[model samples]
Structure formats: C-alpha cells, structure tokens
Target: MSCKYIYSHVVRLLNESDTICIEFEDAMFGRPKSIRLLREDIVRFMEIREIGARQILVYMGHLYKELKKKDKADYFSFLDPGNIPTCPIGTDDRDLSQHIADQLEAVCRDSICLIPYNTGYHWILTIVNEDKNMIHLLNSTSNRNRDDTWKTIVTNGVKMYNASKGISKGPGFKILTGNLKQSGSVECGYCVMRYMKEIVDCDDPQLEKMFAGCIKNQYYTQCQYDEVRSEWSEFVYSYVGA
Candidate 1:
C-alpha cells in the first residue's frame, strides 16, 4: 500500500478502537546490515553528545530507521488489513519485539504504544511516551465497570469513523456501506445497517432480497439513485439468474 493509504487507515482504525496492531514481513532471524547500522544511530543518541555529533547522529539515525522500518515487511502481518500503525517518523528497534504480541499488550497496558506485529517475529518497534497520569487513570477507570461512558465514546467514535471520508470525516458527509444490505430502503443509507443486521439476526440478506424487499414503487422515480436501469443491471449482474 502507498504510505498515504497506510497512514489514513491507521488514523481511522485508531480512532475506531483506540487500539493498535502491528505485523512483520519476515522471519525472526533475518538481520540485514542496514538495520544494524541504523540501530547503531539510536544507541549513540540515547545520551547527550556534542552539538555537531547530535546533528549527524539524528540525520543518519532517521535515514537508517526509515530503511529498517520498510525492510521489516514482517511488521504488517498481525494487523487487520489496511489498519496498522506507522512507526514514528524516525525510529529504530532492537529487543522490544522479541515477543511482539506480548510486548504490544504491555504497551497497551503501560503506555499507549503504537505497535507493529509479525505473525512470527518483529521487524522493528517504535516506543511512544504518553502522560504517565493518563495511563494510571485509564488503568484505574474500572470501579466495578458501571461507568459506560468510555464504551459510548468508543462506539460513537467508530460510527463516525465509518461514516467519514476525507480528513477526519465530519459534517455534510454521507456514509457509504457496500457490505451492508438494509431491510428497508430508508434504513439502507443510514450506515448503521451493520449493527442493525445483528439485531435482526442478520441485516444482510443477498442483494436481491434486500432490494426486492426495500425498493418501493416510487423508488424508480427517485432523484437520488438517478439511474434505475443501471442499478437493476448491476444488481442482476451480481445476483439472480441471467
């Protein structure tokens, strides 16, 4: 995927679940010279060095880290497709990924680390430092689980994310849900149709069943669809006998 798509999907998924996943592209044993060289830069910069040394170190570190990140291709494996965190703009890695899944769960528990995963091994890891108070507070949020506020926030957030399009997906926008087929035409465009399906024990019937049940006689005259014949053609091509 292009970097832009990867980044956008990352933002969407994060806002959706407030959780992150990572994946790796290779086996745990494959170490390239370039990855080693970049990691050296991170080691050198851990403590203060001279100004000139700092500048060179930072630049080289950034270049090397970026190369190592892409090289790991293994990191993208654990995430659901199109939904993985981008390693920080400049980052390097070492042992944090040895048990990537477990470490990410730690990041989830201790820090809000955006992690990458490997079905098998980690390619690299970028650690993010968030406010310690927030971590402590989120950890303490459960006082017998009565406060449903967090769940509401997460649910509404996911809803908006699904409905949105360009840049944060705000007002005047329409949600397009290709996977959901509605019980009735009015409910079809609402986009919450996926959840509605679960309520009905299935909101998604075959496309033909949905259309046959939902379309009213006046639907043929509606301005929104604008191409009744074409719609029918697509529907027939996808389902029903030729």
Candidate 2:
C-alpha cells in the first residue's frame, strides 16, 4: 500500500482519544507481543520529534514479522535496545555477557544482527556480521565517543558467542562515521530505523559494498526521513487496522 494511504489511516486513529494497541505474534521469541502507542507517541511520527524507544521497538518487531513471513528473516535477528546492558563495565559484566551471548546464540552463523543502541541521548545502529566477524557502527550523528561503551559490550558479547561455539577468535570492530548523519538531533532514531531497513533489504554480497560506499559528511534527505515515517505509519495501520 502507498504510504499516504497507510498514514491517513493512522492519522484518523490518532484523532480518536482512545488508546491504540497493536498485538502480533513474535515468531522469533515464540510469544505474542503487544505494543501500545498513546496519542502522544503517535504524534512523534507526525511531527519532527525525538522518537521514543517504544516506537523503535514496535517498528523493529513489525519488521521482524514481515521478514519472517517472507522467509527472509533466517539470516537476521534484532536486539531490543532496552535488553542491551548499559555501560560503565559494572560487576555484572559476566552475567550481562552471558545474557547477550544467549541472544546471539539464537542467530545462525553468517547472519546479520541489527541492534538499535541508545547512548543516553541519541540512537545509533550496531550491525554485527558473524560471517565476517565484523561490527559496523552506524551513527546518524558525529559522536564517536558515545559509542565506546556499546562497542565494548557488543564485542564482549560476540566473544562470548564465539567461545560458546568453540571459536577462539574475536570480532573486528569498525566505526563508520562519515555519511548517513542526521540533520538534527531528533532524527537519530528515525535514521537508525531507516538504516536497519536498508541493510536488511540488501543481498549478502552487497552488504559490504553498501557500507564501503558511504560518502563522507553526507546527511539523509527529507525524503528518506519521510520514507521511514511512512513505513512506520504503514506498519501500525497494518497491525492495528482502522
């Protein structure tokens, strides 16, 4: 369906005062997940506002379901931002490592894991490729320092996953900071979502090329942002109905 048609349905729902809820079965987790978006949450898409984790989570869940339906989700998995352990390397790093490793264990070898990491103030994407043993950090903003903590956590998690599979080598980490920057601070979440969609939509061989082809100091166009917003609106309408 066209984005306009889908967005119109969502706008109509927002006009009503009642709570809007979307419930769908999550094939990856073997359970039903319900997402409730209040009117304010829905408004985030309509306006140029900072999207909450709930909105990202909803979109991720929807994307996972859509991919699974088409049998394209076998080589992909998504980690919830809230489930990722925070920084500072606390005393529970081992437990946290194990928790993250457990999640990666479900992912098959030679697969891509999309993670929307929250750096307290902004959202960025961390793409883990087990095939190449590489972690590509895609941030919409120019803040390389903010990614240090997440890089450590995810690298450790990947190490643990390798250990569990009897592999002794660690993964290589690279921070890609040139292109795909958001124009403003509030667009981080939206950019991350669009990045995920782009990566998932690409073929395996084209993945490396896509990252390597990123131009320096480039920003996402308004059309790209609108595309994400449209997709989000369409997903909500498809699941929630009019």
Candidate 3:
C-alpha cells in the first residue's frame, strides 16, 4: 500500500475513537519535511490502534504542562519518551509503584499491559501477559545488562496488578528478553513503537506474528531517522506554539 493510503486509513481509524483528531500540516521553517513512516512516528501510528498508548501520552503531556506551570525541573522528563526511570531492582519506592499502577489502571482494562521504557540513550518495550504470566522485553539494541530493568518492571508490574485488581500475591511472570533489528543508534525509539505495533497487529495474544515479524524485518537508516525527527520537531514547535 502507498504511504498516503496507509496514513489516511490510520487517520480514519484514529478519528473514529473521538479522542484523537490529528491533522497534517506543512512545516514553515528550514525545509518542509515529508510525512513518512519512521520509527519515531510509530507511537502516533500505533496510537491509532491502541487507545491506551495515546491516552498515556496525553496524560503525560498534561502532567508535564501542569508541572511546568509550577516551574518543576523534571517537567521535561514527562515529555520525552526516552526518560524511563532508572531505579534499580528491588527498590522500595511506593510512590512510583502507585503512580505506575494508577497509569495502568486508568487504561488497561484487559489482562495485557504494554510498557515503553527508555534508558536515557535507548528505548525498549515491555509486554506483560497477565493471563500467561509472562513478560517479554523488546530491545532494538543490545539486550545485555538488562536484568535490572527487567526485574524492576516485573516487580512493579506485580505491585500495579495487585493495586489495580485487589489481588494479594501476584503471579510470577517469566521474563523473556529478545532483540529487534535496528539500523541506526537513534532508531531505538522507533523500534519501541514498532514493538507495540507488532503486538497490536497480531491476532493471538501470544503475539507470535509480532515476534517473527520484528526479527525478520524492521529497520531505519540515519537519514530516515533524521527526517522523521525533523518533521516531528517542526510539528511540535508549530502545534505547541499555536
């Protein structure tokens, strides 16, 4: 399918939700950037399929705006997708745990939970299958030394699950870390969105197609990444300034 066709279809689906009503606008500064599918744009793309993802971004954006009004230093953290908290494994941070649980409970009515995390420089995604008692991690770059983050998410997931559903001891979810294809360093963010896309596009909750599709094909070069970033940067500047 043509890029225009896919984007139009996505926009149609997103508009149906009554929560999203995005429009295409040309950039006024530097050079006009073309709208194309890039790793960076997939969150907006996947948001078309998953209302929870869009709601998360909207809530985070609103939180940042409120914090910014209060002159908070960490306000920008809520705006960036690559700003996952780096609390180590077994950290006893109840506020953070409760906040995560609240975020999940607000959107996640089903058993599955989708999480997007960033380690300052790279982006990774986590999918918790509550029914299957499994946690799968999708990292576009190296998957080494991720045990801490994985464990931290799992630990918090248990807390969130319990709080959201009034459960006692949570089921132990098996952790599975895997690799996704990346064409450039900055593509981690895009890879994270693609991970979400694959999961949403699947027919089965096991997401067999997502696992196979990600491993087989998914990549964006430096130039493509740059174009996407520029386009988004310009759009944000215009939208926020307006």
Q: Which number leads on TM-score?
A: 2
1 against 3, candidate with superior lDDT: 3
Using all chains and alpha carbons, the TM-scores for the candidates as numbered come to: 0.15, 0.84, 0.51
* Model 3, span 1-120: residue lDDT tens: 233433454455433332323222111111222222333343343333222233233333333344345654221222123223655544555655555555555444344566666544
Compared with the true structure, the alpha-carbon lDDT of candidate 1 equals 0.24
Sliding window of 10 residues with minimal summed lDDT for model 3: 25-34
Clashes of each: 16, 0, 1
- Where model 3 places Cα greater than 4 Å from the true spot, the runs are 1-92, 130-132, 174-179, 208-242
Off by over 4 Å in 1: 1-147, 165-242
The model with the greater TM-score, 2 or 3, is 2
Give a tens-digit lDDT track for model 2, residues 1-242: 45566546556755656557876455453345566777677766667589877788877876887788778877787776656656552333566667777777754445678878787778888888856378888888766676776777778888888888788889999876544778777999889888888877776624456767556668889898887777777777665643
lDDT of 3: 0.45
> Could you tell me how far off, in angstroms, the CA of residue 148 lies in candidate 1 after the best superposition?
2.0
lDDT by candidate, in order shown: 0.24, 0.73, 0.45
Query: In model 2, where is the ten-residue run with the lowest total lDDT?
Result: 85-94
Candidate with best lDDT: 2
Tell me the tens digit of each residue's lDDT in model 1 across 1-242: 22233234334433432322112222221221111112222222222121122222222222223335556322211111112322232233222222333322322322222212111111111122222111001111112132133222222322333233222432121111222232332321111212221122322323223223222222212222222223222322221121
